[model samples]
Target: MSLDSTLHEALTALNQGRYKTVLKVAKSGMKRYKSHPAFPNFAGIALSSQGKHRDAAGYFKKALGLDPTFHDARRNLAQALILLQQSDTALTLLNRLLEGAPKDPDGWYLKGQALLNCGQPRAAADAATRSLELNTRQPRALNLRGVARNMLGDEAEAIADFQTALTLNPNDVEALVNISLPLARQTRHAEALEAAERAVHLAPTHLNARLRLAMQLLESGDQDGARDQFQTILGQAPGHAQAIEQLAALNAAAANADLEPIARRALKTAPRQSSDAARLHFALARMARQAGEQEKFASHLTQANGALAHIMPFDSDGDSQQFESLRTRFNAGADQVQAPAPSGPTPIYVLGLPRSGTTLTETLLGAHPNVCPLGERAVPGVLLAPFLENDIAFDTAACAQFVARDQERLPALPDGIRFYIDKMPENYRLIGALLTAYPHARIVHMCRDPRDVALSMWQAHFSGKALSYTYDLAAMAHRFNLYAGLMAHWHSVFPGQILDVQYEDLVTDVDGQSRRLADHIGLKWVEDMAHPERSTGPVLTLSANQVRQPVHSRSVGSWKPYETMLTPFISGLDPNLWPGVQQG
Candidate 1:
């Protein structure tokens, strides 16, 4: 065949999603038209579509070698490198490409992907934005920007991007999966579940789609469905890192020793510094802990934290500086608020540090017939953004607007629900604005032993960048110190408006604490409030499985087991925040 016909055939096959046909055409075309770079580039694309990134990289390199000016081939090579987890090398190539062709939208998008792979979400977001500015019609660029935005905790903007991408391509599985979590976090469980379900339907065997569907199922309180999804993934790919880890976590307390071997085997092949290895190692650690293998647990836990830290590094100094700024501004009443909304469901703000009993407290409140627990909604931060950016006071009119916006943002409330709970742990940062905006808002400050909180956070696997401080011992301690200082400031400023609930005290004396919580939140204490295990509210936190069971003292002093190993975390914590625990 002539070169023109050969190139046309390969390009047509590629555009039609006939990857296998594209490979066949490319192979035949390359044999006759060896001088053409397009043949090798098409072959590389086919290989990449078939999940053969290493093979794709070889073809792409050959294409670039045949024609040094083949920008398409260079971009494809970088994309393959990204898929192969060689992000640093990919970034280098993408940088060189962008420098030469600064107006290339594809180059910017690939650079964003490379930056995202390198854990530079902020930079990735900027690169993605540049691509979109150059070409607004690219759904992939919009989706890429959404992923980066989600990582940077810009859920509202991320969702907007995802929605726009879906408008462009309704069957975009990546956008569907990416948007689900933020929607779920916003308490729009139905929408989240719909997106996840559609992704899985569109790509049944896609690992990420299945994993996301399972997570959405878990978030929507469909444990059985979630378990089925995880089991399906494991059945298809036994060595799937996230599937093994999640399934193990779902059944950890039941002594799911069956998964320990799979996780152990997967860990051997996963890269030492990758998130996959961290998850597998954490799974094994959980299994070891369950089997009473203390030393084994400690060893795996240490390795997991080490691996995770490589991917999720926290800027302790930067975080501290920001905290200092927030404390100073809030202390000076920089964003003072107006009175609470006159008529609406009373807002209950459950704020604290991660793993500080926020979930358990929310569970207890959710059990109340009149309280609707909007599980960990990110609305407070969104509502506080305007005032936080400016040095303006939120007067009564502004407060009314704030309340109106919050109510509109919230999911449709069920009939007879009088108190809507926002149990985001980080809501502690917005206490001042939250109180001012919602005058009748009740604050429940959940406090736990700093040592235990630090340990729990270290062992936990968070989804996004919001909880990245938990990946390191020192970072966790630093976050705790900042959180403590901020909470102290809020307590002094809003005296008697906040109710302090110690986790240990609550777990030990469930009845008394339940009464205190109900009264403080303006609810009548009932027997149902004591039975949180029976409450079917959404449990999207890391403690999802643990919270479904009866409240127990098992996790109260969990830090004691690794007391020696947690010296770094303990040493970094404030002495005054140690509670009843004796610090050596």
Candidate 2:
């Protein structure tokens, strides 16, 4: 075929999603037109479509080298850079593109995405807004703006933007996926699940859509459905890293022995230093632990954490400073701030370190008929931002304003619902603000063995910018110490106001502990509270799988197996706070 005809065939194949055919055509065309940019560009597009981002980036660079003015090649290269987590490099290229074509909506949108990936949400929002102004109907721009807004802690605005994007392009899988996040945060799980299902239905073959659906199902307590979706994805693409990892997690949770071979195979082929490889290594670690391969488990766990750490280094000093400041400030006026009046519906704050029993506690409380669970809402953080930001004194005026703001953001509870649970574990840092706002509000401080909490956090994967401390063992221990100190201060100041529910105690005596919880929250002891597994509400936390199962002591002393690995964490922790763990 002629060179032009060959190029046309490759472009056609690319448009048709026939990546292999495009690769074949591009290879053939490159032989005839050795220096042509189009052939290499087409090859790059094909590779990128197949998720070979690094390989695609190399081809895009080759295309640009052949013809420096190839704008499309530059854009494609930027995309690959972003996918490869080189967001700074991607932003530099995107900025140059936007400078030449200031009104290019696609360029601005790409810039926004790069900025968002780099954790510059404000800049991302600005870029997305500029894109929207240039092309009002740009659905991707709207979705990007929504993501930025969500990251900026403006969930309502984010939801509106996502809805607008969906209206513009109903089949936009990203919009559907992005919309579910804010809904889930607001504890609107049914709506979130519906959005996830629709995204999956519209793009059954799309890996991200299918992954989102599986995750939603898992969080909604449908493990079987999640497993089926994951297995289906694996069947379609055996090397799908996320599917392999999630399936491994599911099997580990259920203690299924069948996933070991599959996980090993995937780990062998998984690329190093990528998020997928990190997750796969984590999965392998879990499976190794299950198989009684202690040394192998430790090796895989280290590899997994190291991979992610290389990608996103945690700011341990900044995190430590922030924790120290929060503890100091909260403790200083712990007894001075007078409690505000009871609001419309009493708020129940379930606060603790991440990977503690917060979700399980929330699920148990949510099983009560008059209680509603709002999974990890950011209302407390939002309400306290002004005070925290400006170092404003905690007073009745601030407390009243906070109460009003909180009530405004809270979703309408069902009739007869007396309490709404906000299960943001980080709210443990904001206990003083929370109690000052509404003293009548129930605060259940979920406590677990610090070592177990640290181990669990180190072992698991988390999305978003929060929980940076979890990336390092010493940081995790330091943060836990901060949490313990803050909790003690709150208990001393509020005396009997904060209910301390030890995870170990709760697991060993569910009925007894749950009855105490009910008494603390001023509710009648209900049998359902003891059986959180029977609760039908969605659990949007990492503990989703654990909460779906009946309460057990399996995790009570889970840190024992990893005692050697956790030596650094144990050493960093205060002996007074974590007594027995030091010797372990």
Candidate 3:
């Protein structure tokens, strides 16, 4: 008395607009298979129509378990699990089914849906693409693929897919909502808003469309528009955590109009966290150095250094080898250069490890009317390529010739843009070659607490930066010490050209330290040097957040709380670099 055939026929009928016969035949067939697998599933599907998800899920799961290879049972089980908000398990099962039918267009389409719910979009895009390759007419696959592609950062492909999905099915809310995000990513605010508004018009209660629109409005400085959108969401869900958290943070930020007073208070108070303590000590040290308080500056610098040394212990020998290995591949000696400096804006490179106030320094210098701080550039390394005698990294003659030919594509020397800042921290290694390229080009090497730098690197997420060494504390320590030893090498190689500005001094006395920097570059300063970010606009780096804000002395000695986690790294740290840390 199996009802498998009847239920299969009913789904076929249902999918083909035979609703009356589907319900009647499905009901009649259900009575015949009292306890059959298809009987329970068909019954569950009917029950789901009446909003009986709890009962439907039990039947679906039982049917799926009884017939493991049953495609309909598995598909229905996934749908049921989705209804119960168990998307992770549903996605896993759906993926398994998809793998079995790898070339099945419909299977790939369903797999994409499961992937979207699981927030595994990068994978979802591949599945969706497979679906389209098998059958280009799959509208659901097109729409889901568009969503997946958007998540994968392929904005152009995503827009086309979404448009095609709309052509196939004009009322596709998923396609409409998915299209707006890529537009936003492209910074096309008005177009994104227009698309999102159309989505809202089509589906008045669509939450995602409203949220995306709200974010764009907020970014465009339409605060009232953003407020209205957020308020509408809160009206539907009073305890929405994301909207609530954003609202709370926004309100809190509004309370503190300026960062200076808070930062000053933080500077006076003893830091509770290791990170906080490090920043304060560094700030105090910098201030002491600037006020010509030699002993106090030395003491504070020692303290700041000691605080950092505890986090990343040095590996002198290993780092020396690693540093040499990189140099053999990248460094350019003056002997490698045969031609004169390529005509262009005089390049000024600012080099240091992360969290060493590179941004602060660049902003201060870039604030001068004559200088343009491009933040970080691949061009310096590009320009220095021909001079670099790294036989291991390139076919030396070919690489040198390639640079000679394409050197003109570099930034045209704009009027008054005399000194260009290339503040890529790793450029410290390239200072030798850079000096070889343009003999008169200035270089600034920023010095900070090695341990603090490592600690900061661990706390931050640098997107896709390839310094895999930063994750391990001991590795970070080794890298920092290695970097320090290299700086020592640069000092001997290029005497009187490189200026070492300790970060601790800069924070303690911004005015005085800025003067030293100005003197090095032979430039006069303006009153705006007091707040570099406020004056040095056109930032194009991760430091944008820290630089957009005013000067703050809250980052020194910031690694103290994580001392326990940092101990492993500290043991290997260079004792000389952070004497205060070793003392602790």
Models ranked on lDDT = 1, 2, 3
Model 1 ranges with Cα > 4 A deviation = 5-36, 54-71, 74-78, 81-203, 220-222, 252-255, 332-343, 382-408, 576-580
Off by over 4 Å in 2: 1-77, 252-257, 333-342, 382-408
lDDT of 2 by residue, 394-473 (tens): 77777777777667667767899999998899988887778777878899988888888888988898876577668778
Evaluate candidate 1 by giving its C-alpha RMSD to the native, one decimal.
4.4
Choose 2 or 3, whichever is better by lDDT. 2
Tens digit of lDDT per residue, candidate 3, span 129-211? 88889999877888888877655545667788988988988887777777776665453556777887888788767778777
lDDT of model 1 at position 393: 60
RMSD of 2: 4.1
TM-score of 1: 0.83
Q: Alpha carbon lDDT of residue 477, candidate 3? A: 75
Off by over 4 Å in 3: 1-32, 42-58, 65-69, 78-103, 112-123, 137-140, 147-153, 166-173, 184-189, 193-205, 217-232, 253-548, 554-584
